[model samples]
Target: MPPAQSALVVGAGAVGVSCALQLARRGVAVTLIDRGPVGGGTSHGNAGAILRAASPIADPGIVWKVPSMLMDPTGPLAIRWRYLPRLAPWLLRFIVESRPERHRANADAIWLLGDQAPDAWRRQVRGAPAETLLSPVGWLKVYSSEASYRAAEGGRALYRARGAALEEFDAHELRQLEPNLAPIFARGVLHADGLFALNPRRLVELCAEAAVAQGAVIRQAEVVDVEADDARAAVTLADGDRLEADRLVLAAGAWSRGLAEKLGAKVPLETERGYHLMFETPERSLNRPVVWEDKSFVLCPMEHGLRLTSQVELAGLEAPPDFRRVETLIPMARRMLPSLAGAPTDRWLGFRPSLPDARPVVGPSPRAGAALLAFGHQHYGLSLAARTGEVVADMALGVDPGFDPTPLSAARWA
Candidate 1:
């Protein structure tokens, strides 16, 4: 192995921080750089769901499946036509990936990344409490229409192949499982291995602080550019400070696409804008995270309060947020959780870095000096972030990753 080297990680969200911390632990003096505060990117205010198999969006069927959803105002996934011009290339790749063959391949890679992701998190924190770090409570899926209930078979099979448990329940059994649910619901599915964090932002912050405690330098600086020589790379901050290192890791979440472009690498990257509204405090709402298929939203009893989150908008990074998109969810959230009678004290929007294929962009960047690319994780950032870190560190140390890196390598889009 090469001598202990220095690495500069550009981006301090879950992926960047995790990679930085993991590398530091492996004897690589690490410095994490970010445009804003640590955990300020998409990592800070996600839906907080740590779903094992529920997050990847590589459905080869979704291309055909999205038309109706796009036309309907209340549909779960939406895209603004105005941004369609910019989103054309991304949408094209998305459509092509909708093919069954491509979707399965992508899904397989993501499942591998996600399945053991939790173990990496456990390894990262070293004895973090399960209660504070995890909520083993399984996920519940409630559907009002029989057709929608049956539609789950396709996804259920996919989960089973990926090793997630899918337990079916009749309307009667569903009512028994969730007595508080409205009688309007008919049938349900239990994602038996479901999990979500009690607080995602807190977890990122804790990881960053932990990394700092262990001698990793965490800095607040927006990376404007990166330069590479024959044998090393360096990141240039917005303020003109250039920090040099032997290796570079790019984990900049939604903002990572532009960096890829700057690096002269072509990656089919786009942002899947996600929104959330959290009430003042936990109203002591029902237990577990509920995916209300009928309502196209989820009401999670977060440590702070009920967080109603869901909706995918394909606007480019420069597009302004349609607060109404977040606002539109209020009524449906109330319908899902009857006890949630209060308006949210806070609202937010974050970018879930997405790829044309719905899997993460991982492994080394080939356009320049030694670089590991770990972005485009979309909704699975937190759930898969730590594992990605371990892999990045393993690559830097020239250690076997124990899994194939072909799917995640930056060479795919080339």
Candidate 2:
């Protein structure tokens, strides 16, 4: 394979923009195409946590709780009855991947990318406007009960073994750290190296700007189809225009499955619809992001307001936003922080492109010689964006990526 002279990247979210930036930096003529303005999709609505010490999604404990969580409308997880049939196949695979051995393997792979996330971001945003978007204040996870806190010991141990700097705080110490939190929280674990984005959407936009400054072209058009031969790839736009390039990178987030399939890889990808609520007039502001263990949500002080974000709804992409999921977060937020005031000023719903095994597809497409697959990042898309872009660029430029790419290969499904 020869180094690609030109590349076409689909989707303009974090992953796509990062890929464009890296490709442009390598002197490759790159065109980034998206339906709307940058960061308007899932990349805009996250909790703004640059979580590098994130745990794997294939936990056996969560598998046992799935049934009850699905049945409870107010629980952390929900599934639309109408989408159940379509979601069954992915759900079954999700369970199979929860086996102890598979779970450990997936966890190790995830940690490898996650542990390097901070450095990657630092290198990517060194002198760019995006540098101001990040806050390295660390993240705190609080538990309301002793048993729940004890159950998290295994995860704590795993993270510690992976070289994460962690500190456990008792109820008194936690209260001293964040005086605004309610007294109900009995224990807390703080990831000392955690980073948060004051505004996640703006971060992506700035990255896009930097890419443009580096000579990447941004095309505000939707990609309808893509075709590739042995030597080059062509992307057909919704307006019937076509673009030919030496390589194609699919980083389209939740909408990537169809595109990947066209490249000859059928990924078991599902849309994990997530909801969030933003409070405009919070009674108090927190110094860092906090995750409630039992509730499975995150409360972070953003540039606009205090954002309460979490919930995994197993509904297909086309379904309407169930505002109840957004509404449910208010009471939970109040319970955690009694000082929270005023009604929610904003509500959002975004789809996280998830895979059954919890690992993203980040290498070459088995079927398409000139195409590379880079989506299915699930919840870690924002955190893993820079590293993924670097790896993808390395692959496109015929350079060594310094590690085995087998773990994230799209051929695993084949």
Candidate 3:
């Protein structure tokens, strides 16, 4: 009888960490590798909107919206001019797939994937030595305009359909709920499913620690290449090191697509370059995370400081991080809450691993069963980490995933 083969997981972001932990938990020999600092990527800088009720930001209307969205540099979402010419076609496909029907379909698929996200995280964190995950109260979405407020109102039906609890808050009610909000902010919506982490760095760092404690090996090296054959997979490192594994799970976030291309799998993976700024503590925050409607970012209260993160720049991974965008977040954040103080203590910009259709790619590679590709989670990467690990692990074990992963696959690109 032969021994079971080892599994190699590339990338050490939240998704990669979660993948490694679940795989190791199942008793697979797991080796987690990364080129740079682990968890230094987008996982650390996200808005911390751990939404169990999150949906893709792309709507069929987005196709039409992109033209205008593309024009504004400081718009909530935009593509840099340098990256625009190459991204035109992808922009088209994104809009085409964002239709109402497509939105609902994608929503169903995404909801399926996110259904048990929080519960899975809770279970993983239960035995781990990680600091508290601020599942804090709930999430608030503020709206300055009536039209936008009404648009948010429509989600009530969608949430009810999906069996997720959602509530709409008028100006007075919203004010009562969050007394600190500026007077100009008239309406708001609260979703009970929202969760946040005060220290995302701590979250992923502790996850890595827990994973190592559970016997998973962490290799600090760049994976220059992953060669797949019928019998096994071999990963070559930039440092001229090589390791073998029976199965390869590519959860490398933004870098996953480029690596997937090495295997001749061309995925429509886009990078949503995101920016976040953490300010000196004004206080514990208005209680929970708030998705400031007009500004198009979520202001979260973390242990580090009041964090403001938003702006999705869809370009390639090679594109530079726009710290200026992160810098811009402070003004909007300060305006929303007068108490937020003068300036941020620290700012960060990281590229979010995004897919053209704003959904993640999971399951077997289009080419081989041995090549498992998981990335393009976009803004929901952290939120979807645990469930995606379960989904990917289920596929690897030949067990049935509780939901359909067809909506999230490389075949979509093929």
Candidate 4:
């Protein structure tokens, strides 16, 4: 296929904006459309850690652990009983993907993108204000139980073999690194090359601005429908406006399933509803983002406040926001960090686009020749955004992205 002269990218979150930026830099005329303001979705309200290495959500034992996780109120995973019927099919696939071999394959693919994330992110924000948004303080994961810490041996060994810059710390060392944190952790592992965003939402906006400077257009509009053929792709806006382009990129994140199905690819994409609580206590800041592994939440200190980000509810998009889920974890958060006092200043809920195998669909639409599909990063969306965008742009411009994108292809489901 010849390089596209014009492209229509649907979604303005991190992935979509990054796609627009990469395409525009390659001299393609790009139009990015989203219903909300830039970075106003999952990209806006994340824990903001760009990990040097990330594992797939489909760990080998996840299948047996789901039952107890659903029953536990303070557990990391939740499901609205009302939505369980609708979520059954997706859950079944997730269990199948949790087999040891499949999980390892997914982990390998995720690390392929994650390993290149830091460099791709720096390149994406070069000479832009967005560069200031990133922090090199690294990421810390602490374990309160020795059982949980020992359970991670396989993954830790894999990270070491992959050449990740890792350092292990005893409880004393962990307390020494973050003096404010309570000395309750049994062990800590730090990814020395990890990056954190001081303000994740602002970073997205700055990236959009950089894309605009590169001649990409960002429009505030809802894409109600999409279609494509061998020659061109098109979108119909909510207001009955229609637009056409030589190529189309579906980077709409959690809401991308309906649009992608319209283009002949039935991707098994589901939403992982995430919630966060923000406390405006800059005085109680940590040097780096800390993951309380046993509790399954991240306590990250950002520019705005200390954010307690957690939860993976199976509720669909139409379900009401369950602020109570995060609220219930507040006492646990306070236990982890005793300085937290009173109520949180703000709360947020967003949806993460997840695939059963934990690898994102980031290549050509199997049936729609002129359309490209890019979503389903699960928890690593922010971590893998720029690299996925680089791959998409390479596909658009008919250039090889220097790696086999076959592992992340949508055809795996077919």
Location of the lowest summed lDDT over 10 successive residues in candidate 2: 49-58
- Candidate 3 residue 279 C-alpha distance from true site, Å: 0.5
lDDT of 1: 0.79
- The local distance difference test score of each candidate is 0.79, 0.88, 0.77, 0.89
Worst 10 residues of 4 by lDDT: 52-61
What TM-score would you give candidate 3 relative to the actual structure?
0.93
Query: Which lDDT tens digits does candidate 4 get at residues 1-414?
Result: 788989999998889989999999889999999999999989999999887656878888777788898788889899888988989999899988888888778888887688888779888987889999999888899999788999888778777877888899998888899888888899999988888988989998988898898899888999999999877999999999999998999999999999989988898899999999999765666888999988889999989889999999989999989888789888888888888777899999999999988899998888887899999988989989988889899999889889888888888888
The candidate, 2 or 3, that scores higher on lDDT is: 2
TM-score (all chains, Cα) for each model: 0.94, 0.97, 0.93, 0.97
Candidate 1 residues lying further than 4 Å off, grouped into runs, are 1-4, 54-58, 129-131, 281-284
* Residue 361's lDDT in candidate 2: 89
Error of 2 at 147 (Å): 0.9
- Please report the candidate that would top lDDT against the real structure: 4
**What lDDT is obtained when candidate 2 is compared to the true structure?**
0.88
RMSD (CA, angstroms), candidate 2: 1.2
**lDDT (10s digit) by residue, model 3, range 1-414:** 122257889988989888888777877788999887778877877777667754777764566666675566557776667877888787777777677887788777778767777777777688566637656566788998787787665566766787776777788888888888787776788878767776776788888888888788999998988877545677899889999887788988887877898765798777778777777778525788888876688888776678887787766677666677557666667778889986678877788877656778887777766777888888788888888887777776767887667888788778
What candidate 3 gets wrong by more than 4 Å, as runs, is: 1-5, 67-74
lDDT of 1 by residue, 177-209 (tens): 776666677788887765667788888888888
**lDDT score for residue 306 of model 3:** 81
Higher-ranked by TM-score: 3 or 4: 4
